[model samples]
Target: MVVPEHRVFDPASSDDRSIYDRLVELGGVHVFDTTATQLHSLRALLPTPPEDVLGEEVRWVHYPWRRSLVRVLGPRGFRLLRLDRNRNKITAAEQDDMARLCVGVVGLSVGHAVAHTLAIEGLCGELRLADFDDLDLSNLNRVPASLFDLDINKTVVAARRIAELDPYMSVVPYPDGLVESTFESFMDGLDIVIDECDSLDTKLVLREHARRRGIPVVMETSDGGILDVERFDLEPERPLLHGLLGDLDASALKNITPEQKAPLAARILDPSKLTPRMLASVPEIGRTLSTWPQLGSDVALGGASVAAVVRAFGIGTPPPSGRIRINLDAHLAAISEVEPTASGESISPANQPR
Candidate 1:
């Protein structure tokens, strides 16, 4: 029998490693994108290193995980203790409350951004992540990942990113993707569910399950920065897809093709609200491109935006429930004038802004 990961990893140990010890241990920490990090010797960095809780002469500690042995700086509890500034926005009590939240994120393409943002804000205590897809060069357009992460399973990639940010955050990854057996468990105790998966079947099924349990669901679509919120807890009998999927049954949704999903997406999201480019591209998907167009900015903002809404929910002040659209094209669209050539032709690349 396969043992569940929770049974194997001690939560208390993970907390200690992240908070008190060197997070970088040879193989456990990797160098990606930029140049390899060069750290001064531990003693050199801290000329007069402070002692640990024991009050003994203390310095560095070896990281607990991974195959290779490596050592680096401190049992830095002092630095962690000095995070009073975080208390300015999130009160000490609220910070503690944030740590108790259990969030479920399905689909890592956009979910990775959501997961990483939550960790940075010290939001989730436990994250239940599900994704079956593998990263490719194409994924870099949205996911804030390195070329090194290419080909890695999306769930695992999100888990690793979460760990790097908040080691204390317990991340349970569904690398095989969400299926029948584990589906129920995935929904059991989530404070909120962030649904970004493409599978229409899973979307409906998840909303049904979450609605029954009174858990709210939030979704961010790729185009025009559209975010849909279903407060199923407040409106228990709310229909799936806000009753958009009323006629269709779950079986019809199973193993659905992209062609089958297009009209449905257009319906729920409203084709009129779709960008002109996206509206035009939908018909030529298979011919011009393999999938829909999404940018790193949109996905990143989507995650951060979800974190803000969820943070409000976690603390006592819940945000207004409904669709929220942060229009990037409208807000951050570039304004530039074409450089004129001596002959009134196109200018050279060198003439463009650096």
Candidate 2:
């Protein structure tokens, strides 16, 4: 009968004795027999076979000493020796690339969902989370936070939760979300920027900065199930957000107070830049907003999906960028390859003289 390797019997512990006796009664022999000759013979069998092969012998036989040894030693133990017996789905190169990626996520509401998904997918190494807002009763409706987190700042909540999930991960939290004062500090050393902020001006500012630095910017708008990607790397000169405002330059647009920027940016719709049919549909869209509030589930799903795409991008995986739109309501998704142009070639979307 072939015996397993790395088995030790502890006679001092009652629990160990009970386990040993049960195994012995079940026709199991300890790998190291007590006979003096057996000890010399087993020692002669130096450099034992691989742990997986040895593990199979003891798989059915439970010995507290061996189990405890394996538990304490981790992968050095019998069970962990068999871990490589299974095939690896992800290639070593891909894992290496994922390990090197550092992504910064802005806005913890939907951003948390994105970060959670990326961590689960094993795509990010370091995550810089920025958010000024605190957890409120209203946030629980859509964010990943628990009811117990109410009233705590969002950055603190996200950092704590993510740390618990992945203790090895590096999470840098900026309790204050991006602002003109904090912009320079936030943009430093980020590989990719995720624009989950609720302000259009903030999005524009982020896009400009990303464009200037040749960083890619991805934005998800839950209202229309839109996942827009501005690959500044591909088209450094293209106006940000696909020139959504038609001809209005950021400077030409009415100067908005910081307090008013959030909501006004949300409601500001540049109809001219949209397809004529879509432009006509705006009135209908307005009516829908007046009649029914946007569903939280829809927004949450949008955020999560966009985050997945971004993770794929970060890990050397191709993302469906260049203006990709996925409309859950219509079950339609499309991608448009944008052509790069000179920065001053076209009039600012908002500044096109009417």
Expressed as tens digits, the lDDT of each residue in 72-130 for candidate 2 is 11112322222222215444456556657777788887787777666655566777778
Q: RMSD per prediction, one decimal?
A: 9.0, 16.1
Tens-digit lDDT track of model 1 for 64-165: 322222222222432233223465587767877877899999999899999888877778678888888899888888898888778878887777665544
Candidate 1: worst 10 consecutive residues by lDDT?
1-10
TM-score of each: 0.75, 0.60
| Candidate 1 residue pairs in clash (backbone atoms < 3 Å) | none
Q: Which segments of candidate 2 are over 4 A away from where they belong? A: 1-89, 247-294, 332-354
Residue 33's lDDT within candidate 1 is 21
Candidate 1 Cα errors over 4 Å, as ranges: 1-84, 332-354
lDDT of each: 0.71, 0.59
Worst 10 residues of 2 by lDDT: 68-77
The best candidate by lDDT is 1
